[model samples]
Each structure stands twice: as C-alpha cells, then as structure tokens.
Target: AAWKAFLNVSQSIIAIAFGAWAYESLGGTHGTPLESNLVAFFGLAVAFFTTNMISVSIFFVIRNKNTFLSVLRQVVGPGGINIVYGLLASPIALIAAFLYDKLYVGGILLIILPIFLIRYSYLSKIQLQQSNQDLLKVLVKTIETRDPYTSGHSLRVSRLARFIALELGLSARRVEMIETAALLHDIGKIDSVYAEIIRKRDRLTDEEHRVIKTHAVKGAELLQSLTSLPEEVIKGVRHHHERYDGKGYPDGLAGKEIPISARIIMLCDSIDAMLSDRPYRAALSVDQVAEEIQRCAGSQFDPDIVAVVLRGETLEKAAAQIREASLPDVVGV
Candidate 1:
C-alpha cells in the first residue's frame, strides 16, 4: 500500500495548497484566523477527498484485476460512504468560516482535527489489510516448508479464483471472500496427523485417503475462531473437495447445493492441481487439462465454472495469464 500512502500524502499537500490559495483569494492574512483557517480547512478537505477518489480509481485501474466497471463500483462504493460524513461536517466548516473574525486557535484546532482523524483512520485500515496479507503469506510459507514442490499453490489458486469470480460478474465483496477461501483451502493439510500422508510418494491406502479427506473439515475448523470471516468463506474452505455430482466427501453437496464460493474453489483447486506436478505424477499437458475439465463438467466440477474458463472470453484471458505466470510444481523436498 505504499502507492496508496503516497497518493494520500500527495493529495493532502495539494489540498493544503488549494486551501491556502482559496483563503488568500477570499481575504489575506489581515482577516481573523478562525474565518481564514475555516475557509482553508473546507477547501483542503474537499480537495483532498476529491483527489483521493481519483487516486483510488487510478490505483485500481493500474492493478487491472477487474473490468473498468467493476473497479469503478469498488472504488466509488467506499468513497461514497466516506463522503457522507464530510458532507455532514460541511455545515460546521461553513459556520467556522463565517465566525473567522471572531475565533482564534480553537477554530484551527477544529479544522485540523478532522484531517488528522481521516488520515490516521485511513492509514490504520491500510496497515490492518497489509497485516492480514502478511499473515496469509506466512501461512503459505509454512505450506511451502511442508511440501516445497507445492510452493505457490495457494497463491495461484487465489489469483485464479479471484479472476474467475470477477469474470462471473459477482460483486467485489463476494469475489474477495472467494479469493480468501482459495488462499486457505488447503489449511487442514498443515495438521501434524496428515504429515506422512501428505509426504508419501506411493499410492495411499484407503484409510490414508480417508484420513486425508478430513483435512477440509479440519482446515475450516482451524480457521473458524481465528478470524471473523463469513460462513461462505469457512464453508468454501471445508467443501472445496466436494464434487458437482454427489460423490464428494465431508458433505455430498451437489450442484447448487454447494456454496458458490466452494464451487469456485473446487474448480480453481483442480486447475492448480492439474497444472502442478505431484510426487506421483508430472503436470498434465495443457490440452489434457482442458479436456479433463470439459469432460468432468457436470460431474466432478461445476459446468458453469468450467464453461467460464474454457469458453468465456474474460476468464479465458485470465486463465491464460495464470498459466503464463504460475510456477511449475517440482517433486522432492
């Protein structure tokens, strides 16, 4: 979020300069401190907020994770909410400006107070998001330590899932949850009980396979209390192994019976698995992977999601990007 912070700082400077200019135009330093400062404060706040909106738009545009309309909605939704408070406080600013000749340092304090609050709160929010991301990275590193060959699996799944979700026309909020679930879908495998099963090079026995299937449930439970994630997120982590047909474990949820987030994870998880090598097998050919997904649709996978990756214009591009960027999964620790 260095970019975000930089934009905020730059916007603040521009706003302050604009405010000072506005104050000078109204009446120079000869006027009372309160009125002049209030005018400056109002000018700065509006300008800062306006420019901040622009920066947010540009920031997301450059990132280009979603369509222009999607990014616009994502940026404008939060900004519109924040702007309400600014509008409400406008009257106070007007009053302060009117009483400029009458007041002193108190008005200046009032003027700076809102700016300080806005900046502090915005920075704090950014820091919190960064911390969560760092935490996810740590978890990914832990997974890598367990299976070096599978390094970057979770991140790839997350990236692919997010793009697919956005392509499906889901709202930004739903897409975010899907991305989070994708990143943590394999969390249950981190349990010590699964160590031997996970590292085994040979075929797993029926009991070992059964034990392995429990990882989905275990992962969801492990994360349930740790974060205030929605039920969709937890369910997605738990039911990612579920099939479109009724054959999946933990829950036999079929078709629409499965949460959309879980359905997304299932498809994404499979794509990553096909692209990634395993201890037992090398990565499949791209053509083979595509054929398998198409063949498995309506049975092993969601036909809709499969169609998106295989046939939809938007998702096809995203899937291609992931293929080009994804790291190959090598065998051996």
Candidate 2:
C-alpha cells in the first residue's frame, strides 16, 4: 500500500512538472512575474487533483476488494465518472483547439483522462461490493446445505462478526465486508474430503480431518476466481483458521501478518461453532465459550480482538440468539 501511494505521488509530481514545462514552451514566458505565478498555481492544482484521484482510487480498491482495472472500468461506466469528466473536459478541448491549436490539445486530454479513469475506478468498486455479497450468499447456502446440523451457522456467524467489527470501530462498509467474509469462511468445506464425516453422526477419520482442513484453501480459490474481491478479503477467507501462534494451516501466518478481517472472522467463527452443538460435541454454554476464547487469547486468537469481543454486550446477545435458533437432531443426523 505504501509503495502504491509513493508511485501515485511521484506520478502526480511528474505530470505537474511536464504541464508547467509545456505551458512555458507555448509562449507563456516564465520571466514575467504574473505568468510565473499563474503557471505555479496551475501546476499545483493539477498535482493536487491528480493526487486526490489516486487517493480515492486506492480507497475504492480497498473498499471493493477489486483489481485496479476493474475499479477503473466501473467508475467510467455509463453516466458515471467518465461522463462527468467528459462534460468538464469537452469545453477545454474545444478552447485549446481554437486558441493555441493542437499544441495545447495534449494538456486538455490529460486533464480529461483522469476524470474518466477515476470515475471508472469508483464505479468498479460498486460492482465489486455487489459481487462479493452475491458470492457470499451462494457460499453460505452451499455450506448450510451440506451440514443440516449447522443450517443457520453462517448467518449467525455473520451477525456476530458484524457486531464485533462495530465494537472495534470499523467503518460500516468494512463491517459489511467482514460479515460477508464470515458468511463464507467455511465454504472450502464444499470440497472437503470429510463430507461423510460431516454427515455421519460419528467421529471423523484421520483422513477426514485432513480433508476438513482443506476448506480454507478451497474457499480462497473460489473467491480468487471472482476477480472483484479485494486481496485482504481473499486473505481473510484463506487464513481464518490460522492461530496467532503460527500453528494454523496453508500458510501459518502469525500475529499481525494475519489480515485484520481474517482475525475478526476467526473469533466469531469459533465462538459460533462452540456455542452450537455438532455431531461430535455438545454445545458449550455461552459463559464457557467466552472463557475458552479468553483463555486462548494470544494463542488461538488475537488479543486485541478478544478484548473487543469481551467488552461487546452485543456479542453475548448474538451468541444467545444462536443458541435459541439451534437446529434439531434431525438436521444434525
């Protein structure tokens, strides 16, 4: 992220410098104080505007979890940023043609292009957000169908995750993404080698355990194909199982290396899973589950996130709600 920011800053500086040079070459003598002042002001504005667009683009990319190209395309799509830019630039282009002729046309083009580019970026973000939600719904449905015992597990987890995110002061949009990711965190189970273990109300085989563990990787692969999701979201989906002590699967990312969203999902997922009965285990009481989570802080969970959850009144209510909505033994069987 820092590198991207640096590149944006550099590009803006270069553009402003080139614009100043071109203006001077086009008979605006820098020797005159008034001309110099105008050139400086224009260059500064261009730089400022360019940097502003870059910042917005970055934010859009993070918000949507989309590739840069996708973001650009959306912002420019139909009556969006592109149209706004075209409206602003068309007159400038016409004026340039009439005044200094084609020599100044390039300047007008540069000014107009960023408009379309930035608009496309913003639009792409909207598309990405919509796509993520749609994909999440599908994933959650698939997981729920596979395990009748956990029919509403994903939904409860999402609610719990969202509450925790809000408690941590995450933005509404971020909380939404975290919720979506939580809803689909177990999606990798679709390809699980332990499908029978999940179905049979008995102990899982060693091989079944191994297969169950592959869900994180599978879920990440599924999300990666969408192309509209952000890297952080993908990481969260992939590493939700990772322990803070670096004992987790796929890549054993520990502590801060684990994406914050993933950390949020991990705690919520565990809490929900523990509070709900599974074929192999009885449902733990809310107090027991909370104590377990607190005991494992800095080992299985992030301490800071655990702290937030502990203080969250909504979290306890969410857990109790999950218990109330518990599935019957027929669903588990």
Candidate 3:
C-alpha cells in the first residue's frame, strides 16, 4: 500500500511537470518571461496537488479490482479529468491570453491541458485500484491460512451477502459496501483470542466464550484503523453477531439499531456455518438448518431477513446457490 501510494504521488508530479513544461514552451511567445514562468509554476503546482490528493484518497477508498476500474473509467470519462485540468489551467491560460497578449497560444493550451489532466488522473486511479485489490487479497489469504476449516469463508460470506443485497433491491453502491464488509467482517479474528478459541473448539469454557465475543470488538477496532474502508464496513464488523433483540454482544445494539450490512452478513455467516461440517459436529441438512433459522427469527435472527431467505425455493436451494456462487471465487484457496 505504501509503495503504491508513493508511485501514485510520483507519477502525478511528473505528469503535472510535463504538462506545465509543454504549456510554458508553446504558450510563452507573447508573454513577459517572468509572468509566463509564474503562471506555469502555479498551474503545475495545482495540478500536482489535486491529482496527488485524489490518487491517495482513492487508493484508500477503493479495494475491489473491478469496481475500482469502473469508478476510474467514470472519473476519467470526457467530462471528469477535463474538469480538473480546466480548473487548474484556467488562471494561467486566462492570464496568458488577455494580460500577456498570448491569445492564440493560451487558447490552444487551454483546449489541450484538460484532456491531458483527465488521462493522467484516470490512469493513476486504475493503477492505485489494482494495487489496493492485490493488497486486500494478500490480507485475506493470511486470514484463511490461520483458519483451515474456514478457508475461503470470507469470500463465501462476501458473495452470499452480495446476492442477498441484490435481492433486497439495494442500490449498486450499497450492495458493494455490504460485499466488501463481508470480506473483512471476521478479520479481527486474526488476533490471539480467536486463535485460542478455535483451538479449543467444542470444549470452550465460559472464559473462552468471553474471549471469543471480543472478536467483534477487535474486528471493529482493526477496521476502524483503516481509513480506506467504508463506515458501513466497520459497523458491520462491529455488529454482525448482534441479534434483532437486545441480547447480542459488544454494544448490545438491537433491531434497527444494527446496520443493514451487519444483518445481511449475520444471516449469510450463520447459513454457512450450519451447512459446513466442523470438528465438533456433522453439517446439518439444509432443511433442518432452515428450520432452526426459522425458529430463531425475531429472537436470534432478523424476522424480515429470515422471511426473505425462506421465500426462496427451499433451504437446500439457498444453500446450493450460496455454494455455487462462492466456490469458484474460493476454490483456489
């Protein structure tokens, strides 16, 4: 991440410098030498600062490969980069045209700089997005390595949550947030408490349960440190275990007080856990698991979400769909 940030900043500076050099060389014919130099310098500085700030912010904000690419495409489209470049070059372009009597050259530069700036910003964003995705994949892999039974769990949870979000008619951006949050929801389990609990498995003592419950809080803390993750993601990690009633842990937040992203993940995670066999017990049949979920609705689970899950063909069908959607994404791991 740090390397990518450095590269992004460096590339932006270079692009700005190159653009200013071009403008100074071609547009200074009728302007006083000092006036032309100052205009060029100011324009370059503004371009550099603006692009650099945006690049760094984007690196932190976007972690998905495809989604980040889409956002970059939109920002670099005809109007996006052009807008930034125009803003940066307008003052210099104007001074050269009117005050410096370099109307023809300044006018030409004003027309050209917008396209250059837009292209530079777009390319930089693409690079940063790719780097961010690579970093996240590494982090997820590390998490999976530590929990063999739950290998690919994060990816599965992310896919299932995304499917539910889509079915619930959420906006594309909102769905994406849920998906990303699911991917990192259990990341805090990388801490020692989680390791100790997992090792103990079936024989957990009361002290162990207390330690395990801290994972939600720890996960939230870990995610909060990452300024790049969306606020919804942090909230989901902090409250995914929270029940619809006021009985859940960490903050004991209830019902609507729990974030939608967390609720979506809670359902998905529970379904996965029930469907998958663990060392302690055999995997439950789909129908039986569904019955359990149905029984728990409005108590352990959200009634509305349970209704949505059950409205589908059957528990077996829902389980099949989750497995189908997630397996390919996770198989290699």
Candidate 4:
C-alpha cells in the first residue's frame, strides 16, 4: 500500500516541483514573483492531493465491487473527505488571491494542514493493514508454488473460512485475520515431506499421516516470531484440525476448549477438502458431503458451525463461491 501510495504521489511530487521551478524561472504574470510562486505551489498541492485520493478510493470500490456508499467509510472516513473538501474549497482561496494578492487564503489551508495530518494518521493505519495483507498474499502464493496440487486450496479455504466466520457473527477484523490465517494455513508443508505426498495417487501410510499432522504445529511455530499477526490468528492456524470431541491432533482441545476461530476454520477446511478431488478418492457429492459433515458433528467438526454452514449453502454452491473468489488467476499455483 505504501509503495502504491508513493507511486500515486510521484506524479504530484513532480508537478509541484516543476510548477515551483517554472514559476521562478519563467517569472510571474500577476502579482509579485514570490507571491505567485507560493500560490502555484499550494494550488498544485491541493489539486494533486485531492486527485490522488479520488483515484485510489475509486480503485478500491471497483476492485472489491462493494456498495458505492462504502466509499464513505473506506475513503471519506479516513480523511479523504477532508482532502476533497480542501480541493473544492481551494477555488475560493485561489479566487480571493486572484482578486487581491495576499497570503491569507493559503494561510487558512495552512491552519487546516494540522487537521489533515491527524486524518492522514488514520490513512496510514489503513495502508499498514493493506501492506500486511499483501505481504501475506505473497507468502501464501509462494507456498502454493511449492505444492502445485494445492494450487487453490489455501485460497478456497480462506474464502470459505471467511464465510463461516461471518456466519458465526465474528467481528469484521477477526474475520479478516482468520481469512488471512486460512490462506497461509498449509504453509508448513512447503519444506516438508508431505509436499511430495500431498497429491499422490495412493493413500498415505500411518507415518505419512503423522507427518502431515505435524504441519499445524510447524505452521504455528513458523509464525510465532513474526509478531505482525494477531495471536488468535496464529492459534487458529495451529488448531484448525483439532476435533470438537478431543480426538484431534496437536493440543486436542475439545468442545469450547477449541478457539472459536479454529472451530469455524475446521469446518470450512473439511468442506473444501471433501469437495475437491484427492489422490485417493474422487470429490464427494453435495448430499454426501452434507451428510458427512452431519455425521462428524461434535466429533471431527464443531456441531454449531456445521449446523450454520449446512443451513443455506450446499456443497456445490460453497464450491462455486470458492472458485469465484479464491481460485488462482492462472493454471499453476
């Protein structure tokens, strides 16, 4: 986000610098040279800032296909409104200065700059969040490259997990974190023996299953020191395979002992796995898949989450959502 923001600002930076340079070099047509130059500098700043804000806000709205009103929260709420207001108000300042050469109009905006600075702090927070999300995406994609069969597995799991999270009434922030964790949940397999066996044509032996189980713990340990992710997210990644009845691997947390995020993710993960083809078996039918989830309730899966997921979407519709939202753009992982 920062790099992209910088790219957005680069043209404005040039425009401002070049405007100032030209103002001094070409000399002013009206008012004193110093006065005209200052007006040009401020005018360009307001113009550039407002234009950049509008473009970025529009990009996000189109990219996410969110409601048009969402722009108020995403853009205007984060000081974008101030930028636009200033840009629109700049005309008054410019006109006043045009009629009578004085620093008062520009000075009014100078006073508003401190408020802009405060609003910009909020913008910075959003950018930092976007940057972390982007970095995780890059990491997830890199891991996918290592295990080609799981090409869209992580992404599909993430979208499904996000759906489950929302269904469970988790806060949006929590849902986003869980989604991020889901995308990188299988990252530990990048260097593990399971990477080779993950898509094998034959069933796994006892030892291979055990090795595959180690991935959850390995993934948590891999992320423990990152410090950027929320603790709940890491915990969910670690315990996503844990059963509701305590027979699951790793910590084997049972019932409420399992983190809610983990429980939600577990169901999402299992559903995607069942819907997709495996080396050992073909994908399960929607009815079969629903029955399987029902059969495993309170044992391998959380009964409450299972009930919620089974309420509306069938296995086929869920699979469709995953394909539309999470599939990789190209053939390879």
Candidate 5:
C-alpha cells in the first residue's frame, strides 16, 4: 500500500509538472487569443491525462505482475468507466483556471467547492466499485461454501470459460462477460431451498431433478435483483442448462436460439463437472471428456462449441489449467 501510495503521488506530481510546462509553452500567461488559450488548456489537460494514464498503467503492470497490454485493456477496455471519468475530470483544472482569470480570488473560492465535490464523488464511485467487487468475491465463496463437493468449482469454470472465449476469437468485453457468467452460473445452488438437494449423496428423484433444473432461472433472477450486472450476464446464467437440440432444462433453448455466452458457459460448466470427482463418479480423463463432448454434440452440447473443444489442444489446455489449479474439497469447512 505504501508503495502504491508513493506511485500515486509520483504520477500526480509528474503529470502536473508536464501539464504546467505545456500550458506555459503555449503562451498561457501572455496576452493570448481565446483560441490559443483554449488550445493551451486542452493541451495541458491532454498532457496531464496521458502522463497519468501511462504512469498508472506502468504501476499496475509492475504491481500486479501482469503484462502492460493487460493493464491497458482493463483501463481502456469494455468496463473502463473509471478511466472515462478521469478523462472527463481532466478538464476541470482548465475550468478552474478560467474562473480564476475572470474573478480572481472569489472565482477561485467559488470553483473550490465544485472541485471538491467532483473529487469526492469520484472517490465515492471508486469505493463503491471496490466494495461491490469485494462483495462478489464473498458471494462466490459463500456459494462454494454451501456445497462442499464443489469447492473452487466456480473459479475453475470461470478460468476455463475465459480461455475458451479467447480461443474462439471473441471480443475482450464478451470474454469478460462470459467469465463472470461462468463464475456465477451456479449461484442458484446457494439458495436455501437447494441446501439438501445440493448435498444429497444419492441420485436425484424425478421431482428433485425438476427442482434442480430451476437453478439456472433462479440464478438469473438472483443476479437481476441483487446486482446491476449486464443483461447478457443474467441471460448467460439463466440459459446455461438449455440443450443445443432443445431437450434440456427450464428453457429448452436450441442451437443459435441460445445466447452465445450461455452456449460457451454451458460447455465450460460441463467440462468442469466432467473433470471433477463427485460421489457418484470419479473424475474423467481429458480424452474421456473430449469423447463425451464429441458423442453429445448436436444433442446435449452446441456442436460448434464441441468442435472447438475437440480441436487442436484446446481441451487439453483447459483441462491442464483446471488440474493445475485443483484444490482440496471444502467438505467440512
């Protein structure tokens, strides 16, 4: 944290210095035309914004031990609203300068309140996003905690889904949504009503099976009521159980009728389940999983997705990742 703080202060200082230089170099202090002043102010804002983005991106790359491009994608990618807010806030300094020139001390004082308010609001937004993410982690943990047999299940599925999405040449935004959906795909199992059904060792009765099928819809409803998540994510959770041939689940969605995210997640979910050991069956080999998928294609699973899984080391890669990340079951925890 202290290192991060130092980096933050350093980046701000560097950005401010660059902005000041650009402003002065553009004849900001002299009797300049209105057009020139506008140019100078925007130049200053751009200088500050660019420098700050670079410095912060570098810090994130180093701190997270991730690649620079990954950091860039997060800042400029699909859900980078915070970065947009920062860009919008960059112009506020120019506004402050303009006010100061017009009304001197009074103008400066007048702008101070708004400046603080904007800063406060931005901070609050950051805090809220952080809190929401923390809450999501807790929920994922709780979901796994409820059913001991599936410890670390959601996380593995999420990773596998991300890999599959990337392999399928999906956009980064779509991949992110798919990963999130996979992580929360089984959230319905966390419902109080699912407690006994989830923990039951024996095979489910016809009634129990029917009740279990409602989980996909229930999970979607839970996300809708509790989160401001995207509609795609909700639909992904809702339709994950639908069969490609229209024979499965609460929605029997067939082929292209199913959302792509749901399609990808449904396959990934099955892959994880097939690979994991359950009371009724031991974990299957990667080859066996591939064979099962191949056999079920066009009926239970999306044939196109099944093809992707069977293609050139794709299933191997996904299975290797899950195996590498295997954790102890949370049976008693």
Candidate 6:
C-alpha cells in the first residue's frame, strides 16, 4: 500500500511538472488572449494526462513483473472506460481551474458538484461490473455446493482456458469472453434435476448419461434467461460438448461451427477432468494428459487450438498453475 501511494505521488509530481513545462513552452503569458492561451491549455492537459498514464503504467509493470501491454490493459479498464473517464475529467478539471482563477472560492464551489458527479458516475459503473461478476461467482459456488466431488472444477477450467486463450494470441475482449464462458460452462448442473447424476459414485447408465448430456444446452438456456449474457458466452456453454468431428452432443456443432470460446473451454474442461481424480479413475499425469489431448485433436478437439496448447510451454504452465492454486488435490492425496 505504501509503495503504491509513493508511486501515485510520484506520478502526480511528474505530471504536474510536465504540464507546467508544456504550458510555458507553448507561450501562454499572464495576459494572453483566450484564443492564444487555449492552445497552451490543451498542450498542458495532454502532457499531464500522457505523463500520468505513462508513469503509472511503468510502476504497474515493474511492481507486478508483467508486460507493458498487460499493465496497459489493467490501467485502461475493460473497453477503455477508464481512459474515457480520464478524458472526460480532464476538460472538467481545466474548466474548474479557470473558474477558480477568475472567481476564487465561488468558482471552486461552482464546479465542485460537477467534479463529484463525474467521479461518482465512473465509480458506479465499475461497481456495477464487479457486482455482476460477483453474482456469477455466487451462482458457481452454488453449483459447487451441489456436488462436492467436483469442487473447484469450474475455476480450474476457467484458469486453464484463460491461459490457452492467451497462448492463442486472442484479443483482450475474446480472452475475457472465453474465461467467463469457461467459468459458467457447467452452470446448468446447478439445476436439481442433475443432482443425483452429478453425485453418483458409480458409472452412469446410458439413460443417466443421456440426461447429463443435456447440461450444455440447459446451461445455455439458463444463462439466456439472464438477458445480459453475450451471444458468444451462450454458444460457449451450449456447444462445449460438441466434438470437432461433429459427433459430440447437443447440436453437434462441427469444426469451426462451434464458437471459439466453446472450443477453448472444451479442451480445457477435458484437461482438468484428466487431472482431477474421479470416483471411477485416478488423475492422469501431465504428460499423459498432453498425450490424450494430442490423440484427440482433429476429432474431439480443435486441431489448431491443440497445436497452440502443445507449442512452447503453454500446456505445462497452465497445468502447473491449476494444480497449484485453482484445483483441489487428487481425491486420495
């Protein structure tokens, strides 16, 4: 916390210095005409905002030991809302400063309400996004409670899917969509109808297995009821079971017919399943899991995505992370 505060203060100081240098260098004298000073004012604002963002971004990169682009994504917020807020606030701040210079305390008081309103609006939007995610997590937790054997399954899949999506060089928006879809992929199992099947220790009979297959479409329908989920997310949950060769399930979306998010989740879901111990089988080693994924490519999994997973250390890194944090130990261990 202290280090963050220090960085913030440093950022402010650097921005202020840059703004002052820009204002003076742009030739704004004490009695300059409003038209002439406008250029200098704009220059000062640009310098301040740019300097501030750069300083803060640098601090985040060093502090987190992450890449600049990743830090930039965090600072900009999803969809660049934070950047929009900063742009909106910049002009307001300049207007406030001008008013204060002209009318002293009265000018300051006049713009105070507007400043607060803008700040409040930005915060409200952020809070609303966070609340929505929390609601999704609560729903996931409910599903977890319904079947203890699959504890942390969704989270592990989500984490692995995120890593795979990143490895595939997907855009930030696509990554978020894939991660969210993976997290809710099994949400349909939350329904009481699947309680017995999910909790059953023995092998499922054909009838019970058929019932379980409905979960993909069921999850999509349940999420569709929310009305706010994106179409990609709905398709991901609906088609995750679909095989690449079109032999899999609920609609049998073949090849690229399945959404990219669904394809990523399908592979990740299977990976986690192999890594986790079930009543019927022990968890497979990482090498064994990789071999299975390779064996299934172009049939059960997307060949392209499987290639990405096998490239470099992506699969190993993803598996290591999930085993260490996102998933429970193998049942006996």
| Most accurate candidate by lDDT | 6
lDDT of each: 0.76, 0.72, 0.72, 0.72, 0.80, 0.82
Using all chains and alpha carbons, the TM-scores for the candidates as numbered come to: 0.69, 0.58, 0.61, 0.63, 0.65, 0.77
For residues 23-77, write the lDDT of model 1, one tens digit per residue.
Answer: 5665546444554465555555666555555666666766764455555555545
User: Any residue pairs clashing in model 6, and if so which?
Assistant: none
lDDT of 5 at 56: 74
TM-score of 3: 0.61
Which model scores highest in TM-score? 6
Candidate 5, residue 164: the lDDT equals 71
Worst 10 residues of 5 by lDDT: 74-83
Q: How far is candidate 4 from the true structure (C-alpha RMSD, Å)?
A: 11.2
Q: Where's the lowest-lDDT run of ten residues in candidate 1? A: 312-321
Candidate 3, backbone clash total: 0
Q: Give per-residue CA lDDT, model 6, range 96-197, as digits (tens).
A: 767877899999999898768989999999899789988998889888886665777898788778877765656567788899999999999988899988
lDDT of 3 by residue, 1-333 (tens): 997778776867766776566556655343356554655555555555456445643663354322333344333433455346656655654555453354566666765677689989999997987797668767877877765777777877887787677556565667878988888888887886577577655778898888888888898898888898789989998899998887988888889899999998888888888887678887788888889999989987888888877866435654675566446544563
Poorest lDDT segment (10 consecutive residues) of candidate 3: 64-73
Model 6: CA > 4 A from native: 15-34, 45-47, 50-67, 70-85, 162-177, 244-246, 291-299, 302-333
lDDT of 4: 0.72
Clashing pairs in 1: 35-100
Greater-lDDT candidate between 3 and 6: 6
lDDT of 2 by residue, 1-333 (tens): 997788777766765566566555554554454433555544444444444455555667786444554444344443345445644553453354344443475766766677689899999998977886777777678767867778888888888887677656565557777877888788777765647767877776787787778889998998899786667778878999999999987799999999888898888888877887777788887789879999999999999999877764655676677757864556553
- Whole-model alpha-carbon lDDT for candidate 1: 0.76
| Candidate 1 positional error at 29, Å | 24
lDDT per residue as tens, model 5, 1-333: 997788788889999999889988876766654455877777787778778877877887676444565566555554555556666776666677677788898988898987789989999997996797668767888878766668778887888788677656565678888888888998888788888888889989999988888888899988999667889999999999889999877777899999988888888888888888889889899989989999999998889878866765666766776677674556874
